[model samples]
Target: MTVSFRDSIALHANALSLREKRNEILASNIANAATPNFQARDFDFEAELARASGPAASQGSGVDATLGYRVPVNRSLDGNTVELSVEQMEFSENTLRYQTSLAFINRRISGLMTAIKGE
Candidate 1:
């Protein structure tokens, strides 16, 4: 397979993994909403993907070594940082992106099969 196709497949796989992690983090945030002094944690998906794929300096050209950071966006009086609205929004967006990535991977596989069969 060509380098571009291979890269595409790899990227999609990374995306799928990232999406799974994001889902878990979001779920955690939602589940902790009721807990007092709970600090909301978030994953930097873009940064994670960059690191997974390659170094921040070489991010565009290849794999980046930058580790994704999890930060709290807001703090509450009781130290609770989980924001229901924000978590829900991120969850929805991540879900959409995951679906898109899956679709692309499936299409690529289909094309490869067609070519292999000389169809």
Candidate 2:
């Protein structure tokens, strides 16, 4: 029997990358909340993750192509689509998810180490 280390953690690793990318997008939106005509951008997490994990996926790239402008609940007079409250919420959520993925990867690696050492 053969075990593939990369395959085991690839999902979580891809998720981590996508989450980090998401954080950047949300942070950028928050940073430009006051700028005129700055459209808020985001990617569909589930969709992006699927593409990233697929065989056809280009490693470490494709987030940019998946990015889409977020539609605001209420239009701003200055034409800015970034809603501070929404951006903040999304950022916080993404951060938590990122931490969770990191934790999972850590735990997996720890288990692998234990196995390797036969301890």
Candidate 3:
């Protein structure tokens, strides 16, 4: 039987893509932290993953409809909502998760290769 890698690997693939997009959003928040009236934006990773696993998986970037503006704990006089510490923590957490997903994908690929080699 011919096994389709897409079926087995699509979730991790989509997760990596979503994580990359999230990284970009988080970076943007950090970059604009000092700008007046700037708002921090983010998305629900779990929601995006669900969309990616659905029939309409190829619609667009998973974040399109899920993008949300963060509510700041402390509002600034300049109206900027990007909190440096919060953004940094989020970015770090996302990065760690991205690395974990990457490792999982790598392990999956290694197992597939071994199976193909009949070893």
Candidate 4:
């Protein structure tokens, strides 16, 4: 079976995009932690990722609402919605995931080279 570079790259590209967005959202939440009445928001990451990857996931998902949905977190009496600890935790987790994905792709490339060299 011929594996096209386009298809292979799509997987990594989409993952990278998701990581980038996650970082942005986390940063935004941290930035607004002290803002009164600011409600913490989070995108439907899994849904967005599925949509970007292919139509199969989109159709199987059966509804588009989840893909782009951003919901507000329950608010405190002070109206500050940013939870610093949670944001930091999520950010660290995402960074690890991103690094893992990159490593996997690199290993794939290395395997391809080994095959080409008949080693």
Model 3, 89-114: lDDT tens digits are: 99999999999999999999999999
Q: How far does residue 105 in candidate 4 sit from its true spot (Å)?
A: 1.5
TM-score of each: 0.78, 0.92, 0.90, 0.74
Best candidate per TM-score, number? 2
lDDT string, candidate 1, 2-86, tens digits: 5666665877877887887778778888898889987777667787787777633343454323334345566677878777888
Ranking of all predicted structures according to TM-score, beginning with the best and ending with the worst: 2, 3, 1, 4
Per-residue lDDT of 1-117 in model 2, one digit per residue for the tens? Answer: 777898789889989989999999899999999999999999899998888888888755644438998999997999999989999999999999999999999999999999999
Candidate 1 clashing pairs?
A: 54-63, 54-64, 55-63, 55-64, 55-65
Per-prediction backbone clash count: 5, 0, 0, 0
Clashing pairs in 3: none
CA lDDT, candidate 2, residue 66: 81
Span of ten consecutive residues with least summed lDDT in model 3? 57-66
Every candidate's lDDT: 0.75, 0.90, 0.89, 0.70
Model 4 scores worst on lDDT over the 10 consecutive residues at 59-68
List the pairs of residues colliding in candidate 4.
Answer: none
lDDT-best of 1 and 2: 2
